[model samples]
Target: MSQPPLVEMIGIEKHFGGVRAVDHVSLDLFPGEVVGVLGHNGAGKSCLMRILAGAMIPNAGEIRVNGSPVSFADPNDAREAGIETIYQTLALADHLDAPSNLFLGRELKTRLGNLDDARMLAESRKVLARLNPNFKNLQDPVSSLSGGQRQVIAIARAIYFDTRVLIMDEPTAALGPSETAMVANLIRQLQSEGIGILLVSHDMHDVFDLCDRVVVMNKGRLVGAHRIDEVTKDDVLSLIVKGELPADWTARNLEAAQ
Candidate 1:
């Protein structure tokens, strides 16, 4: 906890027309830590993360990577700063093979200026193996893969580029229990590799299970943040629905009241 945060968004603000999508929200992410961002459908969580991901420019605020202030004009700039986002859509090219999808834009080229299919396949194999050892259908198009496999491909694309801070939006949204477990294991592996992750999910189980700390947002404002061990699920739910933590929620306060 003494180490400086890997990424910091300070006094972030965004507005669309007359509505404020985000209002002076600040958040920090440290290395090898998973921080969950929870909010309702229109609570501005996605908008906040989009600003971090460089998909949307904030009307006001500053972003710092590794304590250095940086500006992202687009997603490429964020990627260059070691930031990557995997949205709920996954964004894989359905017709492309796993290797192709992995190296979709930033393809590895041979010395002769040809597409490096061999190397791409090998690299894909390595990264995919690290994420999912059971995965084997590299030649098949991503559209043919299972939900979990597709999720793996999306994640593989993100981490393959030495991603330092990952923004995952609804990572386990539509997966079966087994597939959800697979993604959870992958998240743990990423954490072990010292990646800072911002997990935006509505699933309480995913938040509690995968996050080291959880922050709640409501009506375009931050409600509060707490260590996962310091609060119960109902406590977080209260924050989500009520836009604030319950009075006497903390252990110390509860003991005092008792």
Candidate 2:
């Protein structure tokens, strides 16, 4: 039999008082695959990803990693389970350089109780080489780096820690076209490395280009999931806006399958 997906969020629900921020949403991410979560501003995409990342507890649901049931007490628990999240902010200290940001809270220490700068720098370079070969600003503060360069540092941090599942929230947001392309390339590289990625984005182009499958959410519910090749941008737009499959989309899919 084939191996189970890298991670599964089953029947997830979250509520804030009377508001149902997420309602019975389910998502699965497989190894080496990128799944795009597309939705509007209040479509509950962020809430679902937050639950999976252990940033918030769900009102009702279960999370399975590699076919084993797991409950995360907090984000730290998620990290311990090989789950890493890179938000829009990139979560890097602006004053720090690439190596410093890469090893931020989890810095390496020498036997004499000192920072192992040489080892950290070498390891950072090794990982960055795989993600962004042109990245060579080792001592420049992250604030000095361009948008794409900063993204590289964030991704390098996640990958260097042996992340198995990565959740990227609007990674290309606020980036120029070229910078967006750079980040896209890094995401593709991560997918090739066999890491499962849950990409939450408002950009339809990024969704269709980078994701193997597109999952749509609307009004706190899962609208539908379509393979990248199975649906058009307009079809996805209809789902996002209407909270239902586009007219004739089901017919088209059935016809194609037959």
Candidate 3:
């Protein structure tokens, strides 16, 4: 805990016309930790993350990475800062193979400036192996892969570029139990590698199981933040629904339940 946070969003605010999408929100993500951003559909969690990802510019407030202030004009800026976002869409070209997708825009080239298929394949294999050893369909189109495999491809692409802060939105959405488990294991591995993760999820189980801490947002404002062991699922649910912590909420309440 002595180490400084890897990413900090202080007094972040975003407005859509007269509507406030994010209101004076502040968040911190430490190295090797997973912080869940929980909220209903319109609670501004996604907007806040998008700003950090450089997908959207915040109307006000400042973002700090490794204690230095930064401004992102676009997603590429964020990528250069070692921040990557994996949305639910996965964003893969259906016809492209794993290696092609891994280096879609930033393809490696030979000295003569020709596409380097062999080198790209080798690099893809290395990163994918670190994520999923069982994966062997390197030549297969990503559309043919399972949901979990596709998720791996998306995640692999992010980390292959030396991502330091990862924002995953509904990472395990629509996956079966085994696939979800695979993603969970991947998350733990990334954490072990000292990557800071900001997880946005609607599934209580996924948040509780994977996150070290949880922060809730409601009506464009922060409602509550708690450690995983200090709050129950119902406590988070109350914050999401009522826009505030429960009246009698306390860390001891969770200990008593156990």
Give TM-scores for every candidate, taking all chains together and pairing residue i with residue i: 0.92, 0.90, 0.91
**Runs off by more than 4 Å, candidate 2:** 251-258
Tens digits of per-residue lDDT, candidate 2, 1-258, equal 287999989999999999999999888989999999999998999888888888899999999999899998888888888999888788889998889899987899999989999999999999888767888888898899887788878877877887999999998786788878877887898899999999999998899889999999999999988888888888889999998876666545667789
**lDDT per residue, candidate 1, 145-228, as tens digits?**
998899888988998998999999998897888878878988899999999999999989889899999999999999988888
* lDDT of residue 160 for candidate 3: 88
In model 3, the clashing pairs are none
In candidate 3, what residue range of length 10 has the lowest lDDT sum?
A: 248-257
Put down candidate 3 lDDT per residue, 1-258, tens digits, no spaces: 888899999999999999999999999999999999999999999899899989899999999999999999998899999999888788899999999998987899999999999999999999999878998999999999988788888989988898899999898886788878878998899999999999999999889889999999999999888888888898899999998778877795556887
Q: How many residue pairs clash in each candidate?
A: 0, 0, 0
Of 2 and 3, the candidate ranking higher by lDDT: 3
| lDDT for 27 (candidate 3) | 97
**In terms of TM-score, how similar is model 3 to the real structure?**
0.91
Query: What is the total number of backbone clashes in candidate 1?
Result: 0
Worst 10 residues of 2 by lDDT: 246-255
Residue 109 local lDDT, model 1: 100
**Model 2: which residue pairs collide?**
none
